[model samples]
Target: MPRSRGTNGTDMNTELGIVVAGVSTIYGRAVVRWAAAEAHARHAELRLVTAQPAAAVPDRYLPNDVATAHRAAAVRLLADLAGEMATGWPGVIVTTDLATGPPAAVLRAAAEEADLLVVGADDASPFTEAISGSVPGDLLTTSPCPLAVVPRREWTASTALPASAPVVVALDESTISHAALAYGYAAAARTGRPLTVVRCVTAGSFDQAAATAQARLLIAFGELYPDVAVSTEVEPGDPRHVLVAASRRAALLVLGSRGRGRLASSLFGSVSRDLIRRSGCPVVIARTQPAPVALCS
Candidate 1:
């Protein structure tokens, strides 16, 4: 993707990027639309993917007719969706893929060359329910790129975000939170939206010193994106609760896949998974592998 400068000198990815979206149920169509707008905003390509699970039996043991039927159905579905997205989102190049594998495996593979991978919220669609009950959780740890899970809701054909809606990012003591912060800053700058950086401490207590230290991490990004009106908050509550509340007024919520404490060694942190489920807006799990940036201890 080509890079360009934002309105106030914040660098941004401008063109030739790829955004992959999983398509299945009716609600999944909404996911594609949301992704299409994002692709349009970046002047990128939209790749729609639909996966058909491999037969439980070995290929030789399975009936050839059944395999052919599955492939045929997947192809038709993708074709129809591609057509719909083309009409709904003009100017953005749209492509389709039919893969044979588990949903997570298929999406992870598709994300290899994508800048963003989008899926519907769990239980929002049949495909989402089939992905171990949580598509975001399944892909959070393994997606090679950023994963965006959009909730099933009515949205317009345009950006779908109110012009004044702010981009919100939740931070923690984990290194991965830095990736989320950077993603949030870039998103805000790219769209000319305000940013709210939040740090949620444990309930019943507030760590002013810790909060101040975490707030310092934003200094460099703020300088880089001076045009992005930014605000900071250190709230006392459950991280999920605080973020979910913040999400109600946000256009997007950004978080990291892994965080600190007991959830440190887990594949995906509990707070991230919970927010992905309950957030009012789309939740983007920032890339596990990030580009070089200013780091704070």
Candidate 2:
């Protein structure tokens, strides 16, 4: 077996495994729809993990039976969804699991043996503030594997474009961005779409983005994905704004997070959070874990 270097400069091996977070949320269902297809395409198992809160204790009384009841209901919902997916996509093995704690931590724990973790992201609003809040955002830092966040737009094809739309990715000089670039190439290859490399510069256009070392690194990955049509964009504006505008017509948008922390408090940086909420399509948050080395594969 060929070995590839990791962000920490260690060689590693990878297998096909994916974990998807599912709950009673629109984004959650979207996650299932998108990840199930990806699982089948990669010949991987789709494990759906749902989090249920345990009943609270008053330091003396019986455990809240209400919490236990809610947990059971959540489990039943997940099992039903898993059964439906297994029936719809026989090529993809499907399994359901329940965990305790917040959605972010639960999914992260389940993603330990997974190659990729999938979740749903909603546009942050006061109405959804307490509902979905930052579960998807929190996973950015806690996930041990790459994470894909699907919104309603992409899953429902509300953007009025085919999968042939370009696979857009945010780029920078960081290793995490390179990982995102590598993922962008793989996604483009899988969807047969062109790859657009973008860098949002604070001054004088994105001219410097194409001239950076990371740009060269992207070209290196191009050698492995020879047939992926690739282009570069350097826009002069706030990155949070530029990337969102660009994602409108993109078949899929990919980005890298700068955090390695497992804490929910720091899961999303400004850029990742903005895109996750406002982007026009599905977004994949690529990290340096599970090895981004084969990106130049």
Candidate 3:
């Protein structure tokens, strides 16, 4: 991952952060639709924000007049998006913010209050090959909340998914990995989708002890999401490749941070970034999960 010019952190905030440029930026609508679906499902607020350098930016890009015009256009774009969501997704409360500064920095500040920060890929093959800076590119490493970058190809309002389109989640030995599983299961349950638990296994990767641990995690999810149809796969191969391919038929892919061994800091790991670029569906990097609440009788 390239170095980010912004602060890095894990755990998506309670709000939804949608990163938008003045124009559609190509895949912006896909992100908004996805975020709207998420907000509706989680019963959370949607925060649509457009971060810009400045209307009076000191040369290099657009002139002051042109830049100011661009900012105004972007603000209008947010209003249009908010209006569409308000009508299209009734239960999801939508709001907009237009801030002046570095887009990435504004994104980080916005992420601070977002449970999931959604962005669209400027370059379609960004993950497979290499490309320039993207809204979620450098920022991926330090996103305070889980980040979802819908691919240009997958950015659409089509809810037409086959029943087989499951919510596939990658599992690891990390304690935080369970958070990814829980998130995946909940997403599946909410949307009445199936859930698939996958762990990439090498030849001798699953020793008896490891197998038992994996079963434990699967069983835990089953207990929680008893009504959701579930399947398990100990696929043989690289985890990133396996998940990326599987995502072609998936509705979403959820993953956990590859923790800094013992250092106790979180950064978006290699697998998460690779999949975000390559996955056919939306990819979510599970930063942190909110604590379970008890029902008051």
Best by TM-score: 1
User: In order, what lDDT does every prediction score?
Assistant: 0.72, 0.65, 0.63
lDDT of 2: 0.65
TM-score of every candidate: 0.81, 0.77, 0.76
Q: Model 3: runs farther than 4 Å from truth?
A: 1-24, 54-64, 123-138, 173-176, 203-211, 258-268, 289-297
Sorted by TM-score, highest first, which candidate order results? 1, 2, 3
Q: Tens-digit lDDT track for model 1 on 1-297?
A: 233342223334544688999887667677888888888787787888888777778767878997677778878877777777777767767777777788788888888889999888754444566433744345766677888888767544336567778899877543336677788998898788899987666644444564565566577777778899998887766777888899888988887644212222232276666776788998887764444545554
Question: Clashing residue pairs, candidate 3?
Answer: 8-142, 9-142, 10-144, 11-145, 12-115, 12-145, 13-114, 13-115
Better of 2 and 3 by lDDT: 2
User: 180-228 in candidate 2: lDDT tens per residue?
Assistant: 7767888788767899988666643333443555756776787889999
Candidate that scores best on lDDT? 1
Write down the worst ten-residue block by lDDT for model 1. 259-268
For model 3, residues 1-297, the per-residue Cα lDDT tens digits are 111111112233433333322224455676787777777777766777766565464645756777667777888888788888777878556767777667666666777756777776554322212122443344565667666766766454327788778998876433336567767888899888899887766554455664565577667667778999998886787776788888888888887653222111122254555566678988776665443442100
Residue 24 accuracy (lDDT) in model 2? 50
